[model samples]
Target chain A: MMPMKLEDLLRTKPVFVNVGVRSFGDSLREAGYQVIHVDWSPPAGGDQKMAELLDDLL
Target chain B: MTLKEKINAANEEALRRIVAANPVLVDVAPASEVVPGMRDKLILHSGPPVTWERMCGAQRGAAIGMCLFEGWAKDAASAERMLAQGEIAFEPNHHHATVGPMAGTITKNMWVWVVQNKAFGNRAQCRQVESFQQFGDYSKEALSGLQKWRDIWAPTLRAAVRKMDGVMLKPLIARALQMGDEMHNRVVASSSIFANAIAPILVDCGRSKEDVVATLYYIGNHPFLFLGLAMAAGKAAMDPARGIEASTVVTAMARNGTEFGIQVSGLDGEWFTAPSPRVKGLFLPGWKDADAGADMGDSAITETVGWGGAVIGGAPGILTFTGGTAEEALGFSREMRNISVGRSPDYLIPALNFEGAAVGIDIRKVMQTNTVPVIDTAIAHKEPGHSIIGGGIVRPPLECFKKALTRFGEKYKE
Candidate 1:
């Protein structure tokens, strides 16, 4: 896939991919900024060594 | 510019200074040896200044234990008498450029992690982790554990630190955030990383093999060993941001069992406090929520510099410990941004697509949003003499932020 250009990304409504703290997104919206909330979960059920191993595998 | 605008500009400048801070671990030494004004008779406790008369159960227990540890009293009864008679001077750890976890008691003889904000050339110290005493346990087991740390662990670690000249903590912290540590409730990654960094130094310090082995084993097994170092680092990073006039940024957030307190940059040493909020989440197998102590510790220093509970979304593993779902973690992380002025440049949350963790909590934003800062903390027992009962999430009382806002207006508006 072709990489998205920075200018193109900017030209579109800036979607802030907020990963933690939901209030951040609320604040952004209150400020009229577009925010995309990503539901982040621990990879491999929160095991760091397992996550690292999977990262290597994937 | 309008008065509001001027305040905003000053706050922005203060937050910039905070995010720009570079904290490095310089050495390990006894509290009296490194912490300024940490005299032989002075005892530093966490949260805002509270007298021995007002200290809650765990704090009182910890103080008595410290007196016993220092050989100032022959027994707990004697220690209690000394504390009541004002034989030991009590002060907040903040007054001495130090921070402590949980019951947060620091005596002169205890070893401390010395962290320096290289950018500001300011230093902060924190006591080494002890399972019992810091949590208000003064049992024979607890006292022996403290003795082991003093006699064996601290000296070995100090020698290793000296051999290495100093360990740069920021890089390790940065990496640990990526590996799944928020540097607060979930510090497994940072602890392992720190142990690895210092292992070679320990080997090269020319200590007896047995002592080195025991110290290495202790550090390797103790999951929360790096928590104190992180707290000291956080204190160092936040210290430079304090005392900025008209700046509404929060410089500190700490809780004793009875009260939660916060200091705003503009207000300097003044603390706005309220009743300590109860933690809402999981408890240990035998414990119930009713037994939990109110939020306690100076560990919120991590959130001040934009790690720990601030980056919960990046550390999904924390959910297992804090009894929250992945989505809740994400929400918690996003929520902090509402009250913060900016994101950290160094401490990025990998799960958030490498976005910087929210940094520089602004009291104005907290008040405006009616949002109290969220903290992930371990719950202690309400009464003294019990170790940690469980881990959970907590928020500083809204009254604290409201009072801070009131104080800010009073200080800067006129």
Candidate 2:
């Protein structure tokens, strides 16, 4: 139910990185992108996306 | 000698020599402005506890001098009168973002190191470790020693600092970490590196040869000066991560006059505290357990940030005094890596083949492992009477982490 619009229509052939909530069922499914999901815990303070971005930036 | 050999060999001897090197009073300020979490009317001490009765005579006498220095009271009698009147401020050095070695006193005019970490946009501060008043050994001898330090010693050194354009210790510390010098009880590599770095600066600063030589000898002799620099650097690195929602990074670990409090990253500046724990370790010769004090001060953050005792094997010499085995020291270094996020490429442990010391405290790893951080610290007595007796080990209360995780969960949950 977590806006699976991207998950449902996505092609099954290519693996996609799934940056989704752990609460979402599709989180368990395979995709092109490696799945990185946050647990029931809330997002931590600071830039949550900073790590992924640093990867992109650096 | 190779820089490494020179540093390691001179490390302790340097600490011994710093006592006589004559540290001039560079500057002084109130604890609140110079250090964080300080309030008026409270006095701060260093290391672990020593009761008023058992405190080294020298430290007690220094406290009397501090009282006079602060003008809190006219003399020891007036100071005692004010303290007995409950009008004096007594606190631990840890509560503020500063560290003191023994009977650590922060007055309005003491020169402190101000370290700014450009990478993190934070600052950390510390007082000089050159002198020893916390020993409770203050007497006519001790008071004269303090006077000489303030008038004669502190100035020659302050001039040196002026000549050198201030010290940039981060690079040397980074190199030491890689070279097997943990910045805590063992500072051989760091001290040597510091001397090497400063020597060039001293030469270029255009100071008199004698002054430069005096400063050089002083630095060459006392290995612990870098401890303040390392603490300041660690403070700068860690302060930025404070107040991040759901981040479990610890900001400050300090002992107030009465309790040990830790501020976690996710909690955003809330202090979770517990009664101060006692330091466990060997004491100086002739020192007995009854004479030891409870844990005190904010310097342990160096370990929390991964230096101090966390990398003890890098300083095997300290093991003799701190009551640790080399194997255990090595184990501590490796175990710390497990909970940390990265290694400081600058600070390398030589025995580990120039492996970087652990850096960054990861909250997730701490939550999963339940390994509360360990810190090697000095102990002071609980009551206001004594200054510092000896040094030992302590653990940050686990509740601080538990509470941080609980809050981080709530803040980030969908």
Candidate 3:
């Protein structure tokens, strides 16, 4: 990961990639903030074994 | 000092006590043995105090199940009759230094996790998690699971917990926040950590191999097992904030399916209530929004002290279960900061560059911003004798916050 300057990050209009709760994004958009929704679901459709394996490896 | 200054100072002190409180998992014992005021035929429930007449379906089911579990009634009809006849005394879990999950019905014989807040010398308790009855399932299987806990699981885990001299929960929670656990809807990390902590103790307790394996397997399989302990810890953390005059920080937020309620630090035990709102989110196959019960549980205690939905940004894995993207999770955390009074000094969200989780929900800020506290919760079936139907996010009814604000004005405004 490359380090980004805090000042540079702040200079741009804030755009949000909304992952959950559409109302949250709606609230932000109503407040004039830009938002992009990500239709998020669990990796492997929430398989317990896979999740545990990933936890162990990661 | 002006009232405003005093309120601010008191809120800061309340937040300090909340962040400073260290909750340790001290023991596992029957509710009657550990929870003060717990007695035979007495039942503790979630949210504000509600009578049998007003108890929601799932709550009523759990209460009837408790009656059967306690042997006070032989069947559902008899149990309902006993409850209606006032043979069973009901009280809110908050009044008894305890908290429970959905339905949150606890009777005297149930085994409860005992957590102690070392800083304030206050203790809180919660019933152990089980798949069936607690969610209002009154089937034979659910009753059997409870019986199994009473006969086998409880004693095995109790002996193990005793041998380990009690498990310290705060350190595990601190680590879990970094590992994608918000300690509410998703507690995978905390659950795993707890299992890891007690695995060796169970092994060394001289229990039968079958019992040890069964106990460990049970703990490992249930990812939300830590939620009960987390609720107890949250209760301990927030209990000290109660009765701090003029503080507007919310100390408790709970739902009983019928109504949602909150208690402010300044007002102590007084609850401001509104009709419990319907949940909006994903549901299981064959189940839809209409089948879902209203939001329920005392698990929102996690949000009361920080973490849970207030820090969702740190727990992206929860997005999969609750339906959200990582960015929205992060956004949720930042948005909560707008309505909260301070950041937790201990519970930090790694996804937000290790920023402290927002803490101390302030009624003034909530009303001013037109934003209420959000909670990620599991939805139960609308009727009893059914398992959880889905999971979703919900907000405290705006009316509850507005009512609190009105009360604050009446009490503090000159």
Please name the candidate that would achieve the greatest lDDT relative to the true structure. Answer: 3
Q: What DockQ does each listed candidate score?
A: 0.02, 0.02, 0.02
lDDT of each: 0.84, 0.56, 0.86
List clashing residue pairs in candidate 3.
A19-B324, A19-B325, A19-B328, A20-B324, A20-B325
Model 3 score (lDDT): 0.86
Q: Residues B140-168, candidate 1: write the lDDT tens digits.
A: 78888778788888889989988887888
Residue-by-residue lDDT tens digits, candidate 2, B15-102: 2221112112122333446566555555565432334444333444556656765567666777666655557555445445456654
Tell me the deviation in Å of residue B239 in model 2: 1.6
What is the TM-score of each predicted model, taking all chains together? Answer: 0.87, 0.68, 0.88
Q: Global lDDT for candidate 2?
A: 0.56
Ranking by lDDT: 3, 1, 2
Q: lDDT by residue for model 3 over B1-414, one digit each (tens)?
A: 877788889999988898899999888888989999998889999999899998888888888889989899999999999999999999999999999998898888998889999988999998877657878887777888888777777788899988988888888999999898999988999999999889989988877898888888888888888998999999988999999998989999999999999999998879999999888778878889888889899989998888788889888888767777788778888889988889977788888989999989988777655567879988888887787788888888988987787777778767
Over 4 Å off, model 3: A1-58
CAPRI-style class, candidate 2? incorrect
- List the candidate numbers ranked by DockQ, top first: 3, 1, 2
